[model samples]
Target: MTEDEALELLIPGVKSKKLSLEDERKSKDLVKMLGYLPLAIDQVRGFLTEAGYATSIDKYVDVFEKHKEKVIKPVGVVPNAMVQRSNLYTTFELSLAPFVEAGNEPALRILMLGAFFGLAPIDEAIFLEYRKVQPAEARPAMPAQDPWDQIRFRRTVLSLAEQSLVKLHSQQDRFAYSLHPMIREWLRLRVDTNPRSVITWRPWT
Candidate 1:
């Protein structure tokens, strides 16, 4: 969407009531800052219209500027993809902040490792294999003698799905999940940021 379309989307009633000149300008700038992507726009709209985020466009823009760098940088650029990778990364990073702050390593590990699998709907079994061999640091904290099990596995993966970081697919006998391609790239970028935290491996054959 163009800046005008995004502004209207950000402010649902823009057509009915005239916004102040200052507000109109700031809103358009905010839309541009969000990379003019509708998903980013909608997420920012939620921030503005809802509680617990910046109260106004000015403050929200400030928040985005401050935290954007905290998101891992995209490693390789793709030309003219429908979604801007930087903004998508920033948007999801902000969404994931609470989990990170809470130190939910299991959920974060599941999300990061899932990206290593190709874009196909990943079979749950591959994640089972991952849990067995992932680096000690990357593995979720649990008792040394206790084994990770199916119930715990589903809980962690479901957490990622709840955040929209991964798409969950349910079949009659099992569950599978996949990430959006760009999001997969973002996750890989995250993994690349800290080499010691990840173990090298080929994507499942």
Candidate 2:
């Protein structure tokens, strides 16, 4: 979708008369940075609406500019699919923000680990095994005596699936999960950009 079309769909009753030319330009820039995806645009709209004092298009544009390199990048099979590539990353970050903000360590670790496993379906057993071998310091602290409780790990994975950050696929009696390619790239970018995040890929035994 074009930036204009996305803006109209995301914010009903947004008219040219209500927005100044500079604001319109900033809105367009924001939309472009978001890859003109309806989902991403809607996410930004929700964030802005919630942040009443900081709802200006200009302010959003400034924020976008700062992280544009990390969030915006081209990736797709088809030519001219750069924007579509960006759509997934932009929306993925929006979906992930809540977990990060709440400091949900289990959920964050699940997501970060999932990204290392590639975009294909990841067997649930792999994560279960990882939990068994994962060091106590690696696991999120829990109220229960066992920090690596399997039940808590399962719940965290399910929550990530519910948020659409991970796609859950079931075949026959077994279930596996996968992340969108864009989301995997976004997570990789996060690890690369932040010196504090420690992510390592290890074969599932």
Candidate 3:
């Protein structure tokens, strides 16, 4: 998206209140900070619209600057990649920060595991099937409900979808999901840095 397009997306249906010049400038700064990626822009829209957020665009940008590096690391950069992976990392890190702060580890784990499933449309049943074969004792611990359960799993996936981290698709009557190829590469880059996790999950992938 162009900067103007991204700004429009950042604030849709805003006839109710006019933004100050400073606010408009901050909005443009945010759009550029998000690297003009539509997915990142949409995720920022969702974050800003949440009732619990209770902050102005400038303040959110201030907070984002302070804490972005703490959330996700940039790695495995290559020349001529289609999108700006570093900016996506920062944007995605911001999206997941709330969940991380609230100790929603299950959502985090499910996200990481999905990256191993390749860049294809992931059938939701894969999680269930994996859970069925792996003993409960062998499964990784979840801070809350076992996300492997169909109901809990779907909810987690929906949460991820809302953040624009995963794209939800309905195939026939069933659910499947996909990630943008750049996003998938970023996720795999994340996994590559965590050796223990790679060892535990590689065979299954």
| Predicted model with the maximum TM-score | 3
TM per model?
Answer: 0.61, 0.53, 0.77
Would you list the rank order by lDDT, best first? Answer: 3, 1, 2
Q: How far is candidate 3 from the true structure (C-alpha RMSD, Å)?
A: 4.9
TM-score, candidate number 2: 0.53
Cand. 2 Cα-lDDT: 0.62
Between 1 and 2, whose TM-score is larger?
Answer: 1
Q: Model 1 over residues 1-205: C-alpha lDDT tens digits?
A: 8777987888887877798999888988888877788766766665554444447778767777676654533344342453376777776776666667787766676677667777789777765675588654565332122355777767766766655666788789777888878777667666543444452322212
Residue 102 alpha-carbon offset, candidate 2, angstroms: 0.3
> Distance from true position, residue 146, model 2, in Å?
3.8
Off by over 4 Å in 2: 1-82, 133-148, 171-173, 193-197, 200-205
Off by over 4 Å in 3: 15-17, 51-53, 69-83, 141-148, 192-205
lDDT of 3 by residue, 83-112 (tens): 466667667767877777787766777677
TM-score of 3: 0.77
With candidate 1 superimposed using the best TM-score fit, by how many Å does residue 127's alpha carbon deviate from the native? 2.7
How would you encode candidate 2's per-residue C-alpha lDDT over 114-192 as one tens digit per residue? 7778657987676556557876566442222253465675677677776667777777866677877767766665553
Model 1, residue pairs in steric clash: none
